[model samples]
Target: MHIHKLPDDVLHGILQHSCYFQYPDFYKWKRLLLLLSICKRWRHLAIPLVYNRVYLSYYDQSEDTSIVDDEPVETIKGAKTKTNLDLFVINNCASLARYADIRILFTSNAFKGLNQTIERMKSVLKTWSGIKTLSLTLVNDVYFVEHQVTAELYDAAQINQLTKELYNLIPGILNLRLKGSRLDRTNKHLYGKLAGYYNNQLKQLSSRHAIGLSDNIYFAQISKLDILLNSENGYKLSQMCTTSLVHLNIRGVPVNYRWASFKTNNDVEQIVFPHLKTFNISYLSSTPSVDRTGTELYNNGRLKIHFPVLTKLHLWSPLGHCELLASAIFPEKMDTFDVLGSSKTMQVLSNMRIPQVKKLYLNVASTTSNIRHATLQLINKILENSPGSKKNKLIIHEDSIQIDPAVIEWSQLTLLHIGAQINMDIALKVIAKLPNVDELTFYNFVAENIPEEAFALKNTSGCHNKLEALNSSITKLMLGHNELGHSKDAVITVIKYLSVRLESLSLFGAQVAFDTDMSEFVNDYSHIYPNLTNVTFRLLTAKVL
Candidate 1:
């Protein structure tokens, strides 16, 4: 059947599927144009899909006199040289009017014609009456303009002017993201002029700096705000809070009490964010003495701030600082806590009471053997406090040591992922503990630590007896690493020892002869596991039976 002849609904569905979740780029736009040229009906059906999101950029070569006179070509790379974004948008204004999201990127070379470019962009934006999202990026080096004639000075002015123009053009923008840019004093003044203009429209805003959200702009409707703050601007958060803010992500900012200072005992003064649900703070560098002082103040009630509705807290800081923050701000409602730092961070959690955390992820970066042992003890302490009703999920990665079975509540865990190296004895002990584990994944496995006593049972009846004692309920098992010298025997022994009926088995980096090892295993497969049905081998050079 001809594609155009299909029902209109079907054709629309096909077009939607073709560009679903695709990044709007030059190639994607060209592909859509090709489809539009297929037939009039296809064009009519695909118009909305193509114009839903638009990407426009300005690449000025006026500084390069050699290329100023070159004719603009329509080729992929040549398109930038052949046409200015302003002219391109003017020509395709009809299509752009249907766009809901627009991304504009200005190259460093484009500073010469920035005013004209901004005017053109404003003209195009004026046509999109229903635009909801706008992303503006200025690619240039950082510099403050102080009566300078450098190219960067002009570039900064151009960016500031562009943002001002956009503020007037799209007052109802819901989602705005600005990158590789900074908002100068002039831009902040312009933003102040539009304070209440976006108070009810903007829902999410992200920027590289906090200056973009000057004191003038009210975030009454903003729910999510992501910003990268340096030490100089980090204190701005004390004034940026809104009652409606739910999620705030601050990265590359130094930790200090100034961020959430209180002036009085009133709720408004004590709690800047009344309904914040999630708070993510990542420090750029660790200052132990400073952090210690901050934590001490917070614990002693000198630095008081409240997050009544906060449930999910993610923290990435120095080794000792993370635990201090965790202890100071013990959110009773927190159900998920993710900590990323050295083993010392986990060690401090051993003494804390975090009973509400059901999903814990500890990304440790410890090399010393003593810290690893401390980390193990911390894990055990956390598991002991977790509620039995909650199905816990644990993920340990990056330089983590072998998990001791005594620390885990096997029946309470639903998912366990280990992305570190562990020997066969430890692996067996882990399996024996996870009696109710639904899925298990191991990144690197080593059988070199098998005890001589266990190896001596190779031809004895007691071998299977010891293996059968493991009470694993794992339905999916993934084995990774190929360091096992007795690869064939280890596979046989593991399958024989764990009496649980596995539904799926995957071998990663497995080295075994297909004809000799696999054939023998297949012959006894039904006797060993009558319920086993699926098997997969990945990164394995040896063939499978």
Candidate 2:
């Protein structure tokens, strides 16, 4: 005797609970079909679920024809008449419409009962006003018409008419994606017409601006907007819109182009940027000459750009321009200014006057005296300006500047990034001299050069309150790639002598030898080097037991 099967509603609940929508392509229909094929009870529920996403255009006949007597195929007289998805949707119009979700797609062939397809969709489109989503796509195959007596001719107007009619019929569409195949026309008024239509729409909008759509988006709410700019129209388009834009990606803004010319008073007197947070200019080819020299000439030319509330600015170029932008656009309101470069932006950081900068990153490979001097001056200014401030922070890359032992002692530097292998000599010298240096980052330097007495330097085992305060106040300590290869014991012994106030450690590319006993080292080091969280190995492959 067979047990009674569950009802259709119960089966749907079971499927829905299992997150059937997530893996729609695989499980939605597969499981349903498999279960239904086993017995009639499951089939009834499975078939309807499978038919929910039916493509109305799929039933439309494939227009295939074998022209006779050298007659060209695709001609109205010679075209093959095939059943289309539209026809199938129309035949079962009432039943399919009642199911709530019906997708209709149209083909390029206007003669193949295409009008009949649109006629069938009117009821469904009208009745389903409460439909959560509606997507209408008009895809047309580009075909060139050729006759024996005349030159090649193509009729694209027919396809355009159908699309225009369908667009006008839909009153309230939440989500719309239109790929108008042959929308590009030589006529000038066409773009203005399209822009007017888009500006009046209430729904959220995004469209390709090549056909002059970028200059016309006046939508009330545009959270994410992306626009492409060329040398020809970058300034004009920018001057028109971009008042209330939040997130912007400005790519291909011609480097040699002149924006200063727009500084003229031929138009609005006030330079307008009411609200703009994130501004990223990736590609720049502009290289303003440095020879035109004076006080803040370099500063004004570079650092004097306008960004009232800009927190993050990513300029992908050499250090010179970066320095210029940072110094010019160094808003007193900015907190995090990250400079990622091929060489360090020491000069950029140095020349700029950033009084309110809390966190700073300078990632570059090469450095010069001008840049170094600029960096030193920048740091001096920050310390001078923010004497009693607690929130300001600085992080400089390896070998970016020459740190005079005296300068570190005189300034109010709480955090220091020394991207060099911690030598007993330098550590003794730095710790002894810098009374205010609380946090220190020892970057990867040649460990072989670190004199054996790095941690055991007796000239100054104990220094000022700041050096003594390091064990308590210091929060981060980054240890560069300085390995203790064959002599793991020596490395372990060295760490045992390190100050206890160290909080975080970043070991970039240092490897501990495989044959050594790490258990004793781990236990001893963990106890001595308390508050260690991140232990990273850059290019080492060894399982840690």
Instruction: Point to the candidate with the largest TM-score.
Output: 1
Give all TM-scores, in the order shown. 0.69, 0.49
lDDT of 1 by residue, 1-545 (tens): 97657888988898888866634354455566566677788877776676656555545342223234444422222223223344336446434433333322333333333344445546555545555776654443223322232322434455556555656665557876655444433323223333335545778876664443444545667789776653433334434545778898877655443443222233422444577888887765655223333222245444445566777778776434552354344557576767676666766666666637656655555434677665666666666766642556666665457676776554566777776777767887787777777777776665466544444334444233332334555666555555446566665454333322343343322433332233333344444444433443332444321
Clashes of each: 1, 25
Model 2 per-residue lDDT tens digits across residues 138-257: 333334111211432223465445444444544333433322223322111222233334444424222333233344445443333443433333322322333554655555444333
Tell me which residue pairs clash in candidate 1: 72-82
Worst 10 residues of 1 by lDDT: 73-82
Runs in model 2 deviating more than 4 A are: 1-242, 249-270, 278-317, 322-374, 386-424, 427-443, 449-476, 482-517, 524-545
C-alpha lDDT (0 to 100) for residue 56 of candidate 1: 52
280: Cα error in model 1, Å:
3.1
